[model samples]
Target: MLGRMGRPGLIGLAARTAVVAGTATAVSGGIASHQANKANQAAEAQAWEAQQQQAAMNAAAAQAVAAQQAAAPAPQATAGGGSDLMAQLNQLAQLHAQGILSDEEFAAGKAKLLA
Candidate 1:
């Protein structure tokens, strides 16, 4: 049997076993690394999508506020002796007396009404 198989047969068998084990370990490690990277990429994509949705929602809310402001009616200015002006003046005086309006604000409103 030794003559047929030669002296190097045992060493060659050990070398082949080592090579197979090493190859299997390397391939398994590569596959695991690839799967982890794919998972990370998916997580990043989900986070980015969420961020985009939040931004779009914020933009829509801002646009809604601006549209509401634009569509609202402006305060109608009245000429002298009109009930509206007198009512506004009375309200301003009340607010000032209540301390809701500062002295400067009250003075400015009085000047504007007189002007």
Candidate 2:
């Protein structure tokens, strides 16, 4: 071994080949692991974004429903053919002012009250 310098012997050659193969395997494994971690992180981020979007859409839908509910007409105090005609007309006017009733509906109610 002390006088061998021109080329590696069979044992040395085998040792070198093993070292190179081990290093290549380790490096390739490390690269594969890194790429897998990156892919997993990207997938998680996309899922999080999708969840946020769904939550926003749900919130908007809830707000619209709340607005609709707020705009709906309240139940009348008395049934049909009741004696409080003035009260009914006042209620219709209030609903119109609050934008709950359309213009045509307001006119129809007033005409019905007068009739």
Give the candidate number with the greatest TM-score: 2
Cα error of candidate 2 at position 39, Å: 0.5
> Cα lDDT of all candidates, in order?
0.75, 0.77
lDDT of 2 by residue, 34-107 (tens): 99999999999999999999888666655654475468664355666465777768877886787656687678
User: What tens-digit string does per-residue lDDT give for candidate 1 at 32-114?
Assistant: 99999999999999999999998886666556544743675544774555786777678668866876556876788678766
Root-mean-square deviation of every model: 11.3, 12.0
In model 1, the clashing pairs are none
lDDT value, residue 44 of candidate 2: 100
Which whole-number lDDT from 0 to 100 does residue 33 have in model 1?
100
Highest lDDT against the true fold, candidate: 2
